[model samples]
Structure formats: structure tokens, C-alpha cells
Target: MTEMVKGYNFAFIDEYAKREIRRKVLKAVSIPGYQVPFGSRELPIARGWGTGGLQITLSLIGQKDILKIIDQGSDDSVNAVNIKRFIEATTGVFITSDTLKATIIQTRHRIPEEELGDDQILVLQVPYPEPLRIVEPEEKETRRMHAEMDYAKIWVFLYENIVKWKEITIGARYPVMVAGRYIMDPSPIPRYDVPRLNNARTLYLFGAGREKRIYAVPPFTEVKPLEFEDHRFRIENFKGKACELCASTDTFLDEIILDDKRMYTCSDTSFCKKRGNNPRVLKYIDRNQQ
Candidate 1:
């Protein structure tokens, strides 16, 4: 574990603020997909960048907790790197890029390819909290819809997409019905990550600082992506495509153009290295503990 920076609290935020966030989190988990409002405290970072997810991480994190931060599945991205550095300096918690090694994983726009264990907690940074915003612009009306379980507007939106595009045109941030009650935007994670949210062992938490909403999908909870009988929801097909580096066929691949040719690579770079039997990533350990 890194030493906590001087003059800062264990997790940077005051105890009272952490307690309040914890209370909100409890309510969020209990309700399952209900967007519980909280006092989203201003962090050193900008609000839209990841203040929501960072607040939750700081609030729930412990000295012993091992953390992993990823942006769009890349560990070394600018956003991920900066957040990891900030968290490490503030909390003195151990950081790992290896998905399985992290007790709490904070991610923006992607879920790791590896299955998180029951002990793991996944904190997702949410830019938008309302799935009904596309259909209904008003918050009062959206809340009413959620209260009444009225999702007809969203259903129609999907239907219209199918009619116009011959398929559900939503590329990312696909809406899902959690526990058959509330429709939720599962961050901006790709359609490939949608099905992984259903009945997962790990608890999923969503925080939107700009929106001041925190929601959750507890382990084993039902999370069904919105679909129609005729136009069933499907994941992005990468048939005959494999990650160039890892030769992985199952994981989510990011398309890139190199030398005027299309190439696909694993989005989760650490996982890709692991697949290639690279010890560079796996060698990252809690040096203090070791």
C-alpha cells in the first residue's frame, strides 16, 4: 500500500460525507436500479470526468482494499492513469491492473472480460443516469414513469429504430430493465457488456456526479436488456475476428486501422497481456504486503 498523502484524510473526503454516501449506497442496493439521490461532493477532479465513481470509491474504500481503474478497458489510458494516481495518493490503497486482483474496480465505459468474483465490487462512472431521457426530457415525468413502471415510450423508441434501421440502432449505453422495475442506463458500456450485468456474482454500482444520482444492481439481480419478440437484442458480432495481440476470440475487441487495413485488438489490454502469458502485468502485486 502507498503512504497516504500528508494533510489529507484517509480517503480524502470527510467522515460525514463518506457516511452520507454510504447511506445512499445502502438504499441504492436495497432498491435495485432505483436512482437514489445523494450529496455529490466536489472532488479535486472535474465532475464529468469521474467525480461520481471516484466519490463512491473513496467512500467505500479501505486501507486494505486493492483497487483497479480502467477507461474504456485500457488500464494505461489518460483518464485511468490519472484516477489511479489520485486514488493511490489519497487513500494509500494498493492498485492493480489485473482484474481478478482488485477487490474494487472503478471503470468508465467498459467491464473487464474476466468474470469478477462475488467478493469484487464494480463501480461504474455514469455520464447519464436516465434511460428515459431520450423519450422524455422532463425529470418529473420520467420519475412518474419509473414510479408507474411505464416504459411504453422507450419501447416505442426501440420499435422506431427497428423500423428505420432494420435493427436496434443503439450502439452503446443500451438501456436495461433491472429486476423488472426500473429501466437503467448501464453507463456507456458497449452492447457486448450488457448481458454480463445480468445475474452476475459481483455487485454493480453506478454513480453520476453531474446528475447527483447513485444506483445499483446487486449480485444475482435480474438485468434484462430491452428487446422485442421479433427484433431480439443481440451483441456485436465479431465473427472470425480475434485480438491481434492475444489471439483472443471471445473478448470484446476494439477496431483499429493500421496501414490501410482493419485490425482488431482486445479492448482490455491487461487481459490481453495475460492471455499471451505475459508476466509483466501479472507481476504487479501489493509490494507492501509482499
Candidate 2:
């Protein structure tokens, strides 16, 4: 562990930066799907990693906030652990792995298996904030398309995918219509977590530091994944597979290979541990699904 320099502001980011970020966050929340540009300051971490999410977490976190950070749904992952420790050391905020206990969760690639309450806020680390980037690389053109609400290219791309694969081959970073207005990418979260974003009770804030963009999904707002009437959006099916540890069929499972033997386990380590110890946790997952 590196020794901290004496008399630094909380979370390592200066007060001015935090204030500016908060302002941008407010603007993002007001617009829902509109991406708000910000002056992204360089952090100790390099760009394209988690600098975006880290900045957001550091800005919003307070001494009283109970923070939880996870990568691919595991609290023990290297990125998660480092971010959690950094935040704790800087802000002196309490940290926990329990989803229900956390007031704020900063995640990469996954959302927790447990349902988040209205009081909780989810800060997602986004590598690419633009849904139209693949179709239109030019920022000015994409902005013009967004201004005119033109998504023909996006629709065409989806249609072509269906024509070739017979199904939407996109497994992650699924494009969605936010509040039936702007098209937004919900980061690279698995398709399983897409439904959780629909009219979610908790607020969702997306940050892309490398891109210097911030977007949000306010609580109870509409978020529909792009799909056609005949070709509806589908989640990743486990094909009757369940977690070997907790026997959870609904939660996302990670496959591990050991000595050529394949094993399945829950990706959300905390949820799996709780479920393994207490059978009643199944009810929570069921209720959340409803």
C-alpha cells in the first residue's frame, strides 16, 4: 500500500472537480438518455479502464455512504477490490459486499443478482457511451442523427443481424431506447441484466471517462431494448443449467474448467453465499424478477 500524501481532499479528486462532475450528473439525470459532456480529469488509473466510474464514485460518495464495488458481479475481483480499497482509504466510507446494505454500487460488466431499492444508486463503468458509434463513427453525424431522432441505420443493422444469424447475435452492450426518445447503450452488461434496467426503482448513472461522457436512467423511467415485433429481444438462456453451488437457475452462472471438468457457479459471489446458507434468499430473487 502506498502512503497517502498528507492534507489531500477526499477521494483524491479535488473539490472543484467533484463539483463539476456533480453538475454534469445533475444535467444527465434531468435529460435521462442524453449524454452530457464533461471535462474528464486524468486519474491515477489510465483511460479505457475504470477512470470514468471511479470519478463518478468519488464525486458522489460521502463519509456516510456505504459503497459496494464489483466486477463481473464478484466483489473479490481485482478491479473491484482495488477500487473499493481506494475509495475507502480516501473517503473513509464504509464498504460492503451485500447489495442490500450498499447505498451506492459501482460495477463493471454486471449488476448484482439482488434487486436494488429506490434509495440505492448504480454507477456503471462504460467504455463506449454512444449507441450509434458503430453505425456512424463521426460524432457530428451522430449528433445530427440524434437531433433528428434518426435511427434507421441502427434498425438496419439489427435487421441484417437477424437475416444472417436468425437471432440478434449481440450478447452484451445491448442498445436500448431510453424513455422512448434517445438511443442509449447500457454498457457491456450481460443480456440477463437488461430487464433489470426497465423502470428500475433505483437510479442508474453511466460514465465513460475515455469518451468524456455521462448519461443516466432516472428511477421508474422507461428503458426498452431495441427489438422488432416478430423478433423480440431475448435473454441468455442457461438451457436448464443451474449454479452448482446454490442451485440458482435465474442468476447468471460462470462456467469454470478444472482438469477438463466443466463446473457452473453463480457469478454473483455474495448472492451465492447467502443463498447457499439460507434457502429463503430464493424468495428475494423471485420477487425481484416479478
Candidate 3:
């Protein structure tokens, strides 16, 4: 067997990739909600494991900034923990559990419960940022179509979803009105996090590495969720169950599989640990350790 290493790898990504990402981030910060093209490089982390988020974090993180990463809104989740560990190893910057203390938050799937201020920046990992992806699969066609503001196809698509499903089949990643013209994707932050976007003081940025696109929402930017007069934009139904750990009725809960029975449960063990400190997460930790 190989001997144990003395320290962690200093290379999460190369300098060239970090510089390219930094350039894209600068453009994104300058032009809100505009998709800027960048030459994205391959990283050690896989595509689905928040590589985009990690890129943004590496580019933006200074020695002064405190970073917080959460997957499904839990800092202790394996994905979140892994990302956090990677950053901590590379940058040696602070890692925070408190939302308010974090200068930058890298999130997947769910947004934090705490309201972010103007000082904070949120970096979202987007699997697919295009709202018209379902309607128009061709990248070349969609780019030209977006340039012309030809979203007639998207409206028809939504209309058809209603016609067939009786309701919009989109669970998360619901489309939103940006600057009263562009219909943008809120990066799958759950519909609950969509409302938090409107007129918020924080800068929201979206990154999709595989798609090679980055977009932004400026502070106090106009963000209106897509809705009909008869059918309003709503969050995923939890069926009136509080978080098993935090007893929070307001936050989103992850669906659990227990003995083939479905149940809604909180996946944020950090949040749960703050409350009565649920034992399930602890048990999971113990099992993993063993």
C-alpha cells in the first residue's frame, strides 16, 4: 500500500481555468441576466458535482472571504461536505454554517432559510439554464431565437403542459420574468427560493459548466415568477409536514424513502442540528465513520 500523504492537493483546478472562469464571472457581474460564453475547462470534480459552483468559488474567493456550500440546503450533506473540504484545502479561507457570515454561498437544489443581504453573493449550480431547452433542444437555434426575443414557442409549450397535465409539469427550475423581457431560469432553486429573488439586495449568479454559460441577477433587479391569473406560481407540496429535525414548517423538505413508504424529511442536518439536533443525521455520520 502507498504511504499516507502529508497534506492535501493544492490543485483543484489549473491557473488558466481559474482565470477563464474569473473573466466570465466579471462579465456576469457587469451584465445582469446576460448569458456570457466562456471556454470552460475540465476539473478533477465531475460535471454533476457542482463543478460550476467550484469554479465560481475558486475565481471569487479571496483570503478575506468566508465560503459556505450547501447541497439540498444542508452543509453536512456528503456533496456539500466534499465541496467545502475541497475549498478549505485549496484556498484556506473560512468555512461558515451561518448564512449571514458567508461572503459567498455555493448552493445546489435548495436555497438557505436566512435572507441574504446586499453584501452577500449567491452562486447557483445550474444543470440547464435555458428555459427553452425543453421546447428547443438545438443550441444553435435557441441562441439565435433568444437574440430575436422569440419566446412564442415557450408560451405555447407552457400552454400545452396545461392542456395535457392539467397543471404545469415543471416541479422546480420554473421560468421567471427578468427585466420584464427575458424569461430566465432561476437555477432550480425550488419555487420557494424564487420569491426570494425579487428585489433582493444580493447578487445572484448562475453557472452551467457543461453548457458553457454564466448569467447573473443584479441586486434589486426585477424578477417576476411566471404565472397565470388563474394559476399562480407555487412551491413543491410538503403535505403539511414540519422538518423532522428542525420542526420547520416553512422550509423545503427532501422526500425520504423508508421501507418502500414515501415520506417528507429535512435533509439539512446542520439546520436540524441547530434545533433539537436530529439523531438520524448523527446515526448516518456514525455509520459512515465506522
**Best model number under lDDT:** 1
List runs of model 2 lying over 4 Å from the truth: 1-7, 283-290
- Each model's lDDT: 0.92, 0.90, 0.77
**Judged by lDDT against the true structure, how good is candidate 3?**
0.77
- Estimated TM-score for each candidate: 0.94, 0.95, 0.85
lDDT of 3 at 274: 54
Task: Report clash pairs, candidate 3.
Answer: none
- Indicate whether candidate 1 or candidate 3 has the larger lDDT: 1
lDDT, candidate 2, at 211: 95
Better of 2 and 3 by TM-score: 2
Which number leads on TM-score? 2
lDDT by residue (1-290, candidate 3, tens digit) is 12223353433566677788888888876766668888866666788678776777777788899888998888888988887877776767788887778999999987776667779999999888788898999988988877888888887887788889888888889888887767788887788778888888888888887777888888998899878787787777776688665676666677787897766656554555555553332311233455
RMSD of each: 4.6, 2.3, 7.1
lDDT of 2 by residue, 1-290 (tens): 33444676888999999999999999999998999999998887779878888899889988899999999989999988877767776777788999999999999999898988889999999999999998999999998998899999999999999999899878899999999999999999998899889988899999999999999999999999999999999988888888899988878999999897888999999999999998577524365466
